[model samples]
Target: MDALGFSENLRVLRKNKGFTQKDLSDKIGVALSTVAMWETGSRRPGYKTAQRVADTLDVSIDKLLQDEALSGGEYLSENELYSRITPKTRNANHDLLEIREVLRTRPEMKMLFSVSKGATKSDIERAVAIIEALKKDRG
Candidate 1:
């Protein structure tokens, strides 16, 4: 039963498991600061690491990362994401979840924001493909 959001749950679970932040980070293959951020609620884990955290803590994903704010429109809208980015494009129901996750994983290539104006869903798909390829290449 998770009464708190992801951060507090992570902290309590880690301590109960007798794992220091450093130890937990080592097991989950993330920087120690990343674990710190998770505990402090400064950041949330993308799909890449959420399951790893849940498994290490012996908790289900629903129990580990469940948060009220997440259910209350944590995801930004296209207008919010592209307001300063490119307002002319507006929004045509562009589900940017995958793109956002990709960008969160790769901050260096944020220039993709430039494509928001007049960017169709097809354009988004193409950008994801390109970025995924880049991810594989770098790995």
Candidate 2:
């Protein structure tokens, strides 16, 4: 896991979720400077803090630790994967490639894709809403 890669990933994921560093700091119960340091690659959080960041960003720890060497590859972190999986991304032309990459990397979601295949648009909407509700409940 590259520290720079981790920092970059954190920054991108936070921005994607429409959160500023201060908002993330507040939510993760960390100092604003601490978040800044982490994002700047000047510091790294402990396991607990890392977990908190991951949970807040709705991503797995592994996503935050992606190898920098693979940055140019087709690999998409869980954060990017979920972003592309969202309904809003469904209409984006680039999202189709992302969705395919996600399915290739995360076999578990294959069932989700298959189940939603023949379903109405409303069914997908309801499912997404349920998932969002579940996330809120967990948080």
Q: Which candidate is the best by TM-score?
A: 2
For candidate 2, give the lDDT. Answer: 0.84
Off by over 4 Å in 1: 1-4, 68-139
Cα miss at 98, model 2 (Å)? 31
The per-model lDDT (C-alpha) reads 0.73, 0.84
Model 2, position 77: C-alpha lDDT score: 69
Across residues 22-138, which tens digit of lDDT does each residue of candidate 1 receive?
Answer: 999999999999999888877888865888988998876655765533333365464554454444333422446667776788766565575566799998889889989999999
lDDT of 2 by residue, 37-136 (tens): 9989999999888989999999977777665522355686667766746576556747788889889889889889988899999999999999999999
Tell how far residue 26 is off in model 2, in angstroms: 0.2
- Model 2: residues with Cα > 4 Å off, grouped in runs: 69-139
What shift in Å separates residue 55 of candidate 1 from its native position after superposition?
A: 0.5
